[model samples]
Target: MTATTLDAVTPAGAAARRPVSGTVHSWDLSTGVDGPGSRFVTFLSGCPLQCLYCQNPDTLRMRNGRRVAADEIVAEAAKYRRFIRAAGGGATISGGEPLLQPVFAGELFHRFKHELGYHTALDTSGYLGARATDALLRDVDLVLLDIKSWDRDTYRKVTGRSLEPTLDFARRLADLGKEVWVRFVLVPGLTDDPANIERVAAFAASLGNVSRVDVLPFHKLGEAKWAALGMDFALRDTPSPTPREVAEAREIFASQGLTAV
Candidate 1:
């Protein structure tokens, strides 16, 4: 988000000088939910933020991830290449902040694009977007960018990081005309605020590159995970968005002329 360093990386740079390894939490073969078509989604490991509502808190630490070479991951994904292609999906590299391991994630994405000849998508918070090399972004066909909140105070409280970085990255993507799908989680008493959503939608509209918006209703499904990790679940009493609430949120995005699903 700070000006990009992506241009500084070369395919034969450090990425190729050694075995670019990424810490992986898991991977899944899923329908077009993450991007277009059926995809081979790799959940890379490590993150800088400690979001209060993380569903996979287990993946928050670098030590918890299994180290792996980028090539090895591509080989594993290659097995399902045909299936993924036939289903119109390709590959998606998600995180625990995929940007945390920029070189590793970039290598995997680069290989998928050059060797596998498949579309690639990156799921990131953009908190570490400055870590991403331009080469990495070029390989990405789409981005599932999560802009958690628009209010500065609320944003800091929600993600424990500055909101400007995400906006900077979003602006950079818009400048590149990259296709984006924005995901917003609806926590009724929190992110579901009308003004907050309106501001988010307005900012997204200004971007002009966003094609889809997903209004995800928050749930307590991660309560058990929090307990297992011995972390207090502050939103335990917060309820999920009602149908009416979700509709209203979606309507806000739609007012911007963007498709809100």
Candidate 2:
């Protein structure tokens, strides 16, 4: 739904013209889950993966979003700037894969971190991590990286994408010494394999830059959204992981000498 307009004269014809625009699903304020504290989270639209457990199925496509300029998003966040700062939270660019609109995401980070002096985070699957420029990473204070599954085929079954790209991106983030919080969903039948959990734990531990690991238990909260979108909810019968399973998965990460919660 978002389109960039180029001048007929030249690419840099207008200084007043917005430098970047993107498809935005929505924005909200959240605490505890998104980042360090309270966060002004902007959910950009468009994702390459078709993760069966994706909660925001409505954000799967670009056309389903509203076209907005980066300035508009930042200005909205400015209204909550004082409150966010007081809570020890900041701005986070989340998505249907934030890297899908790298330029727009980068601009948001620049404005939020440099201009507003707030902590910035990117919540991404890292499927398109290659799209992130060095400058963009420089502005990001934390990365909420989703490592869906560790087994290659299981990853594909869960997300319909290759697992290597996410791993490659994690390594890249490690090399940059960027702060990261690795997020993994515990699906009772699909992703709870002990070996898979161990692989994910080991990989995250090897990163050396990972600060925390969040073992999120999967639920059916998004089934209605999928039903509304007329899409198949493949994991409808899948149950949430039991407390013991969740605790055990967390223990796997702890065994790797990584903090898991």
Candidate 3:
């Protein structure tokens, strides 16, 4: 993520009750992995990063989504309150990068908390974490932070962006005692290096607020999307890490005392 990822909003403003609007790519009532049990997940549109493995390349453009109002989303989420609450689940504002529509996302999350009385989570890449202010985070019950890599050069190679911004965001979240679920992708011959994984584990361990770590195995699931978008599928030659590799990476996080899932 880059500063441009959050080009749609700035930090430091108090969240308002008005009907703020944003672009949405899609949504689903998902379970298990998003956050907690089951969730009413809203996928916002636009992202600045060009991660070669992006599964939803269709959602990467800022101008390609339908504009939606926060109240509409809140109303939709409210309808699912009974089922979601019973499942120990909540609402998640995910995206190509939700921070891109900061005001809209903040308002939706605030409503989810104060109005619906449900858990609110932000599934983010933390590239735009700098744009998430205290007021916004205040309403967020959890943050599923995807820390792609720990090495600076390796990070740039992986996501085509700098690493400092993400770390800065993670530290800020830590300072606030926010519950964080760290997600790292394990790609063979690229991000599967043990030293790199260890570094990530060490940093997450230092945070003292990370509740869990998810070591996701790399996959070519997005290959067809890349072809459809006329983007080169660079990972055609890059293999997904084997099951053993996934286990080893999880072990590394566990060794650092992180709860690996």
Please report the candidate that would top lDDT against the real structure: 2
Worst 10 residues of 3 by lDDT: 3-12
Local distance difference test, per candidate? 0.84, 0.89, 0.86
Residue-level lDDT for 99 in candidate 3: 85
Q: Summarize candidate 3's per-residue lDDT along 121-159 as a digit string, tens digits.
A: 999999988878788999999999988988888889878
Give the clashing pairs for model 2: none
lDDT of 2: 0.89
Top candidate (TM-score): 2
Candidate 3 CA-lDDT value: 0.86
**Tens digits of lDDT, candidate 1, 84-117:** 8788889999978898878778888888888888
User: Could you tell which candidate, 1 or 2, scores higher by TM-score?
Assistant: 2
Off by over 4 Å in 2: 2-17
- The C-alpha TM-scores of every prediction are 0.93, 0.94, 0.93
Across 10-83, the per-residue lDDT of candidate 2 in tens digits comes to: 11123664456778999999998999999999998889999999999998888889888777888999999889
For model 3, the superposed segments whose C-alpha errors exceed 4 Å read: 1-18
Residue 64, candidate 1: alpha-carbon lDDT? 68
